[model samples]
Target: MHTLKVDSVQLAFNDRKILQDVYLHCNQGEVIGLLGRNGSGKSSLLKIIFGTLTPSYKYVGIDDEFIHYGYLNNRIAYLSQDSYLPRGIKISDLAAMLIDQLYWDDFANLDIYKNHHHKKPEQLSGGELRQLEMLMILCSKADFILLDEPFTHVTPVETQYFKTIIKSISKTKGIIITDHQYYNVLDISDRVILLTDGCTKHLKNVDDLVTYNYLSGIK
Candidate 1:
């Protein structure tokens, strides 16, 4: 089966080690929820796997073949917390470029885009823009996607909508997602893992999150 794997990931800034001996793997048709406390290197790890950040050391591979440039390989997509789309482009134009034409209607039907198809990213509210950005990434041709803080600015209703979209797309894509909203992550994940002390810990249950101090307690 196709898989994206990152092993022996080591990164540091000056004397501070951000990540070390970290490992993670995700296969096609699976959603892996990544949870961590603030400063636990979750975002940095995603950046390293996506090839946007040059770590001190890392081994990223797809199906046992080491990939030198993850982003340029056409097999990986990343949705950063910050806006990555061009502000001047119309929503329809951007959607056409990233998604298949057959899926255009499905994207257009989304509440976030239905009324703003002709508007530019700059004209949308923060929540609207964020939702649009996520939809574009999810609809991309890549087989593996990394999403950072996807639920940050959206309402609870919108967050649930995004989760449904994610589940639908994950039927053919491997997704690695991280957000401060841990419950949402847990809700959508096929499996969940925690990053702590520069290592990855496979979680067996929500209680494990509390054990690792990633959560105050199970809800």
Candidate 2:
């Protein structure tokens, strides 16, 4: 079973603290949503999990095994708000770069990759590009996936599309996602972790989140 366990992780940047005593646990068939306001270290935490950002203090694990920052580039898949795809790169080639026919064939059956078969990453619209990036992540060999603001630039339809993909991924893989779109996040998330003032509090349900004023517009 794919699982991600982050224990007592702490991080700082340029003498400023970002994450303090952070801990997270996720497993297959579960969707964990990381929620917080802007500049609240939401993305930083995701980067720390994916090893893109080095932590001043930390311990992140996967399947009970310790994970190192240097080697996480290949072991985890990350989708950022920016498509960040290389300009002029072909979409088919990008997918191929992640995985080959054996994996692509299995991944393509998922609804997210249906329309992204051969489209160029640069030629795609914002939604298409985001979807492509997500599809690539799904097809990769990474045991854990970190998605940062996947619905930020996409349309409502695209948002729903990606949500379905996320739900599907959680059924077979461990996924940690952060999005400002709180409503949609709640709709798909099996568990919600609210980050406030650099601390995390797990909410049991949507009502719990609302009662705690974690849901937007409820305060």
Candidate 3:
């Protein structure tokens, strides 16, 4: 099975350390949920693994082979919190560029695509645009995907739908997803880890979230 591993990820801003000695790994057919509070360096760690943000130190590898330009590699894809699609581009055209032709029919059949296939980014609402962006990334050629705050600005139904898509695609791809929506992350992840106090902690159960201050209580 294909595996992506990131370890010894150390980052700092000026004199303040953000991520220190963080480690995470995910193999194909697995969705690893990442939980962290605001400013816990979750996004920074992802950027470091994706090679978009230079950390003080890090070791990133796939299948035991070290890679430098992670983002440039076709084997990995990173979907940032902000919208990645360019304005004025039709959804159909964007699909042509990112998604394989074999999956074109599947992509076209999605509810969002069926309604917005010919429309530009500006023509769709924020949630609609987010759904389209996610579908494109999930269906891309990348074998590994890093999703940052994918549930943001999306409705509960949309969030659940995205979870289903993530689970389905993960049969062939390794996914590492992080969001403030902890319950959703918990429900979908094959395994969950928390980034707390600049380290990674394996979560045993829902109560672990509370122990790590990720959640107040089960409620």
Structural similarity to truth (TM-score) of each candidate: 0.94, 0.86, 0.95
> What's the CA error at residue 95 for candidate 1, in Å?
1.5
The per-prediction tally of clashing pairs is 0, 0, 0
Using TM-score, give the best candidate's number: 3
Model 3, TM vs. native: 0.95
Candidate 2, lDDT over the whole model: 0.75
In candidate 1, clashing pairs total 0
Q: State the local distance difference test value for candidate 3.
A: 0.89
Tens-digit lDDT track for model 2 on 108-156?
5755456665656666777666766776776576767788888877889
**How well does candidate 3 match the true structure, expressed as C-alpha RMSD?**
1.3
Over 4 Å off in model 2, which ranges? 70-73, 100-103, 106-119, 210-212, 216-219
Considering summed lDDT, which 10 consecutive residues are worst modelled in model 3? 67-76
Per-residue accuracy of model 1 over 80-150 as CA lDDT, tens digit each: 98999897889888887787565677877887778888899899988888888899899887889999999
